[model samples]
Target: MDRIVVQAAAFDAGAEIASLREHDASVGAVAAFVGQVRDLNGAQGVDVLELEHYPGMTEASLAAIVADAHARWSLRGVTVIHRVGPLKPCDPIVLVAVASAHRGEAFQACEFVMDFLKTEAPFWKKETADGVSRWVEARERDDIAKQRWQGAGADEATQDKATHDKATHDKATEGTRARPRRA
Candidate 1:
């Protein structure tokens, strides 16, 4: 897994995918997606989009997400890039690619990686359009959506819930087995 930034330079998504597949002979498939700045966003027509992130923290967050994908899926390679700074319309904003031994894992891991990047990574968007520049917020739904990624390794709350459930289930099973049939 690798994460990078090209500053003002544009990235080739296809080139990134090729690099991932070229390294491993076992890679049977590669899935990738690129997001770009659009000319219009709903009521507002986009002029330019600026992305910002806390330098070291941004990279760390993204690297952790890729690592999570490796742990969750049998992935061969993953590459991600989320541009920072001003981007014109049609300029690429983000790139994600996944390679695996099978197409299923490749596709699913690609989606998983992209989704996690959207919600988990701390990238802020400032869209200057419709004569307004506003900061984007992580939607309430974004919070709820990201909760699905909260694995047992993520927090004590989830681990605690699993432990509690396990203990309750074990006790119930033991009690049921210990009770003889009433016949």
Candidate 2:
């Protein structure tokens, strides 16, 4: 809760790491994650990327992600930075570093925050190929990734919605199968 950073420019991982370590002696480990812009998207190879984020909502959204991670685990310091605007291949897209008394908690918190950010964060990435750019939507892989990191016990409504959605989807598939196919 003491540290919050959300920016539209590329972040320096080494400098950030050093800053995190300063004035924090109780931390036994600092785990970090940095996401980059890859050059491939399906059939085409991406040459550039234009990322956009809601100004007001973006900060609030990332802060909420940090807060959620702190609430879920015992964390000492948390820092998250995501870049916007145009980016090239190998450019750092996001950074997440978590400090805790132990390594396990720090690692888990870092990964968890990333997974949640990929799925829940408001930033959007649009891959550009030969100057064509399109907004990337949430993917099934992202959802699955987030699902894997969900705490051992989740809230009642979330559990209920997951179960309810599955049941509804299953019934819909069954109904389609039971009906005659169109010629």
Candidate 3:
């Protein structure tokens, strides 16, 4: 089973991981990544981080990323949680957890989900520093990270399938490039 949540409330990472493995004795390894709001972005000192997204579209994009992960790996379960609204430094922003029969599959799937989420999800972020707020621009490093996953999973057939699926997802969510302001 896959669990996906997009909410404004903070989440418990340990609880989420436990939930992913519940009643699943076959899961021998679990990999999880928790992203937190940073206190600084380069030279600026960040006071708060605000995130916004088109509700339904954001969930759909995350689901597509998880689906792609399943297509490439034999994952027993997956959980993804993303928080929106204003958050202070150290607040958990996102969580990606993967459970599998082997460590390799779990680790790879967790990393793949995060890489895709960073680029594919239609989430916009703004940071406040020294009482000034500015919209955060997408980083080139994230694009490079996503590109590394291309043709790099499972067998050739699976890689082709994932590629096709990703293309379809990208086409479906392309219009969301123009992000909306925080409501």
**Candidate with maximal lDDT:** 3
> Sorted by TM-score, highest first, which candidate order results?
3, 2, 1
| Residue pairs in collision within model 1 | none
Models 1 onward score TM values of 0.73, 0.76, 0.80
Residue 77 in model 3: lDDT: 93
> 1-183, model 1: which lDDT tens digit per residue?
465553557898878888998868988789898999877666456587888878888788878877877876677788888888999888998988888775655665677677777886778888898778988767777666566556445564664565456546756654421111110
State candidate 1's TM-score: 0.73
Query: Distance from true position, residue 164, model 3, in Å?
Result: 24
lDDT (Cα, tens digit) per residue for candidate 3, span 99-177: 9876656877899999999999999999999889999999999998888777454654575665456546645765312
* Alpha-carbon shift of residue 158 in model 3 (angstroms): 16
Task: For candidate 2, report its TM-score.
Answer: 0.76
| Native-referenced Cα lDDT, model 2 | 0.74
Write candidate 2's Cα lDDT for 1-183 as tens digits: 346566667788988877877788977779999889887755465578888778888888878888878776677789888888889888998889998766656776798788988887778788788667777777899888888655355653564465456546756654421111111
Give the whole-model CA lDDT for all candidates, comma-separated: 0.73, 0.74, 0.84
Model 2: CA > 4 A from native? 41-46, 151-183
